[model samples]
Target: MVKSELEKLGLHFTNIDLGVIEIKETISKEQKQKLKSNLAVSGLELLDDHKSILVDKIKNVIIEMVHYSDELPKVNYSDYISEKLGYDYTYLSNLFSEVKGITIQHFIINHKIERAKELILYDELNLTEISYRLHYSSVAHLSNQFKKVTGQSPTFYKKIGKKRKSNLENL
Candidate 1:
């Protein structure tokens, strides 16, 4: 759908994946605005701002690390992020903190915890496997972090799952 739309505007896109479109030729302002408007009609905004780009890169890196990668990197996260972004870890950290109002570490932990919840809900891997997959030092460490964020143990949360639907009349 997106590829056809781009072609309709006489743009040659080498790649059109999800939110990305790779065009080889430079486009005029009118063409750019037309493309932007077309995309906006379908609820996609073109973000060309440098700060937004950097912030998005930071988020994508963390998301890929936590959710998609088969194995967590052996190196510390700071080194991993620096290598991935080709920028000093400190600079990335400062920029992320300023824009997102949280440290990168916190962001990573939040993703990890969400993954942990999904794994627990899936009822496939044991806590030990999950801890190792996510690179927590131990099950105890994972439990502590999960409890800290959720106010409940992972086991307790999983067991609770969802209560039978409540009735408003019962109130």
Candidate 2:
């Protein structure tokens, strides 16, 4: 979708991926504005500012790791995010909190809890399995986080159907 939009504007790019686009040439202000407008039509926003771009990158990496990866990495998340973005964990955490108004750890926990809700809704995984899949240390920990975040238990969520689940984008 994004690639086609860029092509429509006659822009050249060396690479494009989730949360990142590398144009082959510098685009003028008008061209950037046009591209932003075009992308907005598809519910996408261009992040040209350095801090916003980095924050978006942080969100993307966390989202992918939490919601998409088959297995969560075993390393500490701060270490993982820092290594992934090549910035000090403190720097990234401060910038993320300053811009998004939430700590990185809080963001990851929200995503983890949401993913757990999704798995619970599927009815294919028990709480223990869901905890394991989400890399929680134990079922109790997962249940605690789930209850803290959603005001309900995982079992309650399973019995309640789909209303309690959150759309990933909204988080």
Candidate 3:
């Protein structure tokens, strides 16, 4: 995995997840190039270069917003993404589709579903509460989307047990 490769290269990662990694110190250009080469072997690559930095920045913002926010906001995602990345939403969308092969909205929905699963597993709140917390229009809406993505109703997902839980990194 990329983490092991980075460790072998004498880089210590503070966090390692599916699409991102954070290290204690900044790596040099040469080191970064080498890291990119190594990561490419596993179908990963550096995302911070000039041509692709906007897409990377957008992805990072979405991850942070979904994983860290207690309540999802009602603000327009395109506006938020534009402000966060300092690029027009249209441009970001085009580049993201071209590079990642998925729309930004699809990515956000994936993260939201992942968050929903986590909240459901914790058993701290009912479906209605989780729906409100995550800004879904209604519990029915949430259930529909959840089933569409995961192929099971929230109740069924819970009753089936936690063995089917997905990795947070896979969101």
Candidate 4:
């Protein structure tokens, strides 16, 4: 549906995954407004202003954990998410599931796996180092999750290699 809309607007998009869509050209504010209106007409929301604050809070915590923390604290993710977002865990969980169609745990895993990929690609650290950096229980656990999500072992994925890397937004 979104693809068809973009096509009708003469816009080219490279990827559409879950809640994200990637397009090459920068859209003007007027174009964005039109797109939003069109999406609303089709019963889809283009901008979720109401959820932005909560989303940002959730994303900030994840980013901080993934990028800044050397050791992840032993705390419940749901509790942490709820505390940070100032919402009940169940409510936040339900809202996230409704909007993303995937659990928060899955989303975190995907982000973590992507972070692991970046660490691997840099070649600055070994698997153990990467595991520690990403707060995986062990290298084996990290490898298992990576394989499960990507359908290839981390070593194999690195060997085949990415021609271009994904930015944070794209990831």
Best by TM-score: 2
lDDT of 3 by residue, 1-171 (tens): 887788877888889876668889888888888888988888877787665766777888998888798865568788888887788899898889988999999998898899888889898999999998877889999999999999999998887655554544356
Top model by lDDT, which number? 2
Full-model lDDT for every candidate: 0.87, 0.91, 0.84, 0.79
After superposition, which runs of candidate 2 have C-alpha atoms over 4 Å from their true positions? 1-10, 162-171
| Steric clash count of candidate 1 | 0
TM-score of each model, in listed order: 0.81, 0.85, 0.70, 0.60
On residues 1-171, what C-alpha lDDT tens digit does candidate 2 reach at each position? 889988988999999987789999889898899999989998999999999999999999999999999799899899999999999999999999999999999999999998998888888888888899899999999999999999998888787765444544356
lDDT of 4 by residue, 46-134 (tens): 75466754665566777777667666656767877777767898887777777678878888899899888888888888999898777
lDDT of 3: 0.84
Clashing pairs in 2: none
Q: How well does candidate 4 match the true structure in TM-score terms?
A: 0.60
Higher-ranked by lDDT: 2 or 4? 2
Model 1, span 1-171: residue lDDT tens: 677678888999788775567898998888889888898898877766777678788899899999999699999999998999899999999999998999999999999999999888887899999999999999999999999989999999887763311333356
Angstrom error at residue 54, model 3: 1.8
RMSD of each: 3.8, 5.2, 7.4, 11.1
TM-score of 3: 0.70
Candidate with more favorable, higher TM-score: 2 or 4? 2
